[model samples]
Target: MAHFPVNHPARPLYRVLSGLIGLYILVFGVYGVAETWGDGLFSREDTSALGLRTNLAFSLVSVIFGAFLIIGASRRGNLGHYMNLTAGAVFLVTGILMMSVLQTQVNILNFSMATVIVSLLFGLILLATGLYDKVGTEEHAEEERRRREHPIAEAHR
Candidate 1:
């Protein structure tokens, strides 16, 4: 729960991307739930976002996960980055698995080609963002320390 400065060089990118991803996912889940709110959780016939059969219970889980991402993103700390990375990995793996097992398995969590591709791409974005913009990493800490210890001399132009 360390507080990173919002003005940190990479903070804006981190916040924007995290927030966007979270918002999209949250909306996606909400849509799915609304689509099947009265169908008793998992419908045997309701297809939803990414071709998955929408289930109230599963949709709630998605919404919670999305909220987690959004909450983490609101922070200036590294928590959001970590969450993005983990969530992305999950989405990527699950999407691929779903695609592979599409025909053989009767799953409420389903997939199409678009779903697989989107998940893979989103996962990559999350991983890249997390890897690139961490605040307390050794390199960033070192750079900060240097800035504090050795202020740049003003030009006397």
Candidate 2:
């Protein structure tokens, strides 16, 4: 089984980081929407927002995802853990998928290389945050620490 740290010492920092990312995404989406208001949903016209290429469809999706991440970061339980994990996976998959269609007509998100890079980066950060942000009691944390330090002994028990 995967061992995610419980009651991690740096949980607050991770939460803050996630929240900041959410804020950036939200702002970027709003800016993108403003810049591409009259464009088609999947407009192929070169439109950039906050150093990332975007279209109406992508901007709307970003708004939704950014809000979801912000809500997840504010949660104080395992819901945040699960939300972060899901968001991370979605970002990673979206990055890879968009990269694959970068030069094709199917690039509906208008993703530039920079946009793909940001998506992958955010995915990794969120994944790490989820792995270490599990909320638990001190006793659970102690047991997790002990198991990590003495895997063989723990497995034998």
Candidate 3:
């Protein structure tokens, strides 16, 4: 059996961010479904067009991904290893689509603001997670080097 290093303090931070993402997704899905229902079963202009289907699909996918993130974080799984990057890419693509292709003729502010905020959060998470992983790798490498070079100085029975 191989022993891995102790969990880094940054691990908790990663988990917290994952939880936040989960909350965002869950809330978005719940709100989206409720709004559609509250609006007389998708009778609005947006719904009648195609926004309803797109929003619902996006919300469902988000909910599923968010749940996985939360579960993986709780179990200390390696989900965080790629989740941040994947999420960031997803947000970037969606943001571009929302700003360009899905731009509404009226009430553009709200749409732009929401997309921008989500995109920025994704970017931040990606950067932070990537940096943490790099730092941990460097620390582990340094530890290994020290162990190899100063073995006799800290000899064990």
Candidate 4:
């Protein structure tokens, strides 16, 4: 049998960061569901995170999001880029909404001051991670160097 080489300079960082985010969201959602046993997905009850007031719907969304991120990060595609970008934008908007008076009208995630802060911070991080690949040509040059250096191993394989 033979195996092909997969040279992705950004994959390591992408997997690490996305995996962490996925784990966090998945665990948070699972805990939320556990705390709200019989309640429906769209329940108005608070999440397991005390005083957060975020509902079950948000928890479900979190679970889905986490799963997607894991899948995206595990594969060699543009999933990470899109997922991070989308999540960053959405969370940023959610934070902005939390800070605004419309929070009550769309209290999907129990937009509090702390939530706003955390959301903004995470959003920025994701945004940065998503855009990391495009910042410079250094990564590309490094990848090329690795490829050239390992040509012998690749041929022997």
Highest lDDT model number: 2
lDDT of 1 at 57: 65
Write the residue-wise lDDT of candidate 4 on 1-157 in tens digits.
Answer: 6322233466578568867877776776667666766777556554555344455676677778778767756655556666777887887887787688434655655455776786788678777666643322556556556667998875776
Per-residue lDDT of model 2, residues 1-157, tens digit only: 9878899889999999888988899999999999999999999899999999999999999999889989999999988889888988999999999999999999999999999999999999998898888999889989988998999999999
Q: Which digits, one per residue and each the tens of the lDDT, describe model 3 over residues 13-118?
A: 8667766776666666666655454443313235311132324445455567667556544554455645655665666666665666444553222244455566
TM-score of each: 0.72, 0.94, 0.58, 0.67
lDDT of 1 by residue, 40-101 (tens): 65445546764545567667877997898788778766677677768778877877786787
What do the candidate models score in CA lDDT, each in turn?
A: 0.68, 0.93, 0.53, 0.65
Q: How do the candidates rank by TM-score, highest first?
A: 2, 1, 4, 3
- Kindly give the stretch of ten consecutive residues in candidate 4 with the minimal lDDT sum: 2-11
Query: Which candidate, 3 or 4, has the higher lDDT?
Result: 4
- Candidate 3 has a TM-score of 0.58
| Model 1, TM vs. native | 0.72
CA error at residue 20 for candidate 1, angstroms: 0.5
Stretches > 4 Å off in candidate 3: 1-8, 37-54, 104-111, 130-157
lDDT of 3 at 12: 72
Output the number of the TM-score-best candidate.
2
